[model samples]
Target: MVFSNKQLLQKALEENGTALTIVELSQKTQLQVAKIRQTLTTWEKDIVRIGPQTYDLKWRVYCGKTFRHTPQAIEIEKGILSTETDVYYYLIASFDYRAKITLYDEDDVAYPLTDRKQSKNLKLSYLSGLSKWFKKYNFEVNDDILFTCKDIKTHEFKIRRQKKQERDEFIIAAKNRRLADLVYDIINHTLPKQEGDMFLIRKYVYVYPFNDPVPPDGLIKVLANNKRFLISNIDKMYSWTGHRIKDFLTVGLRKYYLQNDKKDWIPVIIDTDEFGKYGYCSQCSERVIWESDIGWHHTKTDFESAESYIPNEFFTSDNSKTRMN
Candidate 1:
């Protein structure tokens, strides 16, 4: 009763809810040890390897689970204004309140100059710059500048503020003796918190105050939610949870898992001193292009709209959507 690689892996997943080590897989599948490893590499597309030896089938499975859905509200607005000799476009989207400014060359090619962290600051800067740029070029500026703002009337701010408050509560819990002791007790006694010597749950893994705070949930949830948790092309279904489980079982945990297994992972740092500076593109002398909001589309009207002002191709027939929008 020998099973194929796919069938063997499927059986292993059905028996194990969320984690499987390479040694455990080999025992269950009754396949040669070397052959099992080879099969895993070949089938990496469907399988997510969490650590050096742990693996899981990549698919969302809910036996009787229901996830509460709370959709985040998003707002968007766009406006077009006409000057005596030029047209100006403006757009604003909700979330963190950022603004993108683009300058057009003589060929109609748009080069994004800056992305302001605050929307109000962006509006003021652009307004001042537009007046100066237009006057210097002797071009008749359009007075009918389009202005739009969306989601201005919602309680989204309150919701986000509440969530932030809750997150702070959890952070406080980590420091409190009673709460920390209770969490540790649960991990040690009740939960299957250890795989080999490493902590099964990533939250239990300790870090110094200098390091970034541990994620609220265990590595399982982190891997499940983050798209960049696993190797992309090799295992499309690989997730953070799977990666965490794999690392715990095989690599002894404590190490940060990254999509590129060959490279060591670094924590994100927020430096207040270096914030709010304009970043320049090394490839182009013009300001670096920032696609913070409003994706560009290739339309005849959009192209012709700026043809008279810029000498470059403002629009192209190649319809590719960039993350800029």
Candidate 2:
């Protein structure tokens, strides 16, 4: 039976519990060596590199969860003690939510510097209080010490802080104006015509009124509704925004569509002749194409009457409507 990249990855992870080498994963999944390498790279954001040439199977479970664990690395040169201290200070200030900070003496082991100080483990509360310390000292932390945390929590905290910083930066760049105007500017600049043009922009913010979950029914409602959007916008908003669109339709908009009976879930865009003439190739064929094409192909349409499901706004221009007609 055939399996998608997602499915194959899931299977490989399930079969091999913690970490898996690239060679072992390729052999077990029967996937091309190159494809396995590519998948490993794509999955790196979600997976943890336990050792050299080994990846932990975390992506399958924590696909896109906010608190998912990721990997991070910090390097410091020898003799740069001040620089290392400053790095730790900044890290604690930035990620007190999910990271625990600790300070080690010159001996490479942690010990309380003062009698009043609690155990060596730095708590969230202490890290949160760092801003006050920085303001009082007029200088940053030293740079020679090593700091570590629970890998997953550290990753999650970094992701959250980075996202917040990015959103704030965008809002500041956009002159702290309304989201609607930002959206308008983005749409205008990115897709001037909105044909097949696609691009992704990171760092977006949104605002919604607070009182009601559905953002007041009418225009005259007032509440402190605000939401921040931050993601690399892919061309055709549906690629990333589609998930948001789906959520809106189900929960916010109360609209739903029946699922099609076909096995594939992804929407396709291609002509009938193209699909028919190039139905996916069977294995052992003399195609000489890349190994990555193992399970990628256009799905066959069952000749059902195609519906005009494209949004009405997409046809605002008379010329576009005429072409569709």
Candidate 3:
């Protein structure tokens, strides 16, 4: 039922199409002509004067990924080339009609964008002169060329090479999409072996030695919320670095056992939660294991912990306390 003066003006202009005369905007917005005129000056850059008492809020946006030049034509996606396919639809509908198309740089200077699939289809034109422009700008293959277009009668386009810090910003975006996976890989393989499953990803790079530039925010987000990791405490997160730990209670502790000092099979305790299972092994003289069966290989002299092999005293706390070694 109500709107701020700025909101009303913006709503009216948006509903009325690209450009609207002051009277039409005022009537739609329910604002007086003098008030609209006075408010227009404050939005100088956003509101443009294309004709008498007419204002337009320009639509300028980057068209596609900024790409380096190659011999092959730029592959622009259909939806991207222009938001409104009015021009394309018209061209297709009227086969005999001819239309003038042009591309403009920031300067008012216009170039013929009218070219066919084969050659210099762009107006004021880039074929032979494109190289000269690149030379003048000193752009590189890694540099990004931002492509944007303004709201105007014809095709109003701009192509400019990002410089210095601006180029860094573009590169950072690419790192977000691509380098994040590399960071994830590094985290996956070296984990559970590193400082026991608890460390900040950003600090991990600095704490440990690595060549990769510290992972960007994107990489951090992926590694932090991954499902493979069990988040012990969201308030105080730590990695599950003890998967392959030497201790008896560690989960998945058998990627491999830490080599035991004892060379022969001896007595050991297998802790299957409450069901106490005792066994023998060359791996360790006497140890408590969480896994009931570790699947060790042995002969009868090698085969340890058979059902009949247990001495009744072996269950006694007194005998269990004694170490054979």
* Leading candidate by lDDT: 3
TM-score of 3: 0.24
Candidate-wise lDDT, in order: 0.31, 0.28, 0.36
Model 2, 116-174: lDDT tens per residue? 22234421112222222222323222211112222333332111112222223343323
Q: How many backbone clashes does candidate 1 have?
A: 23
Off by over 4 Å in 2: 1-3, 48-52, 58-129, 132-145, 151-325
Query: Pairing residues by index, what is the TM-score of model 2?
Result: 0.24
Local lDDT at 23 for model 1: 81
Off by over 4 Å in 3: 1-101, 106-108, 118-132, 163-166, 170-325
In the range 242-267, model 1's lDDT, one tens digit per residue, is 33233222211111121123332211
- Candidate 3: what lDDT? 0.36
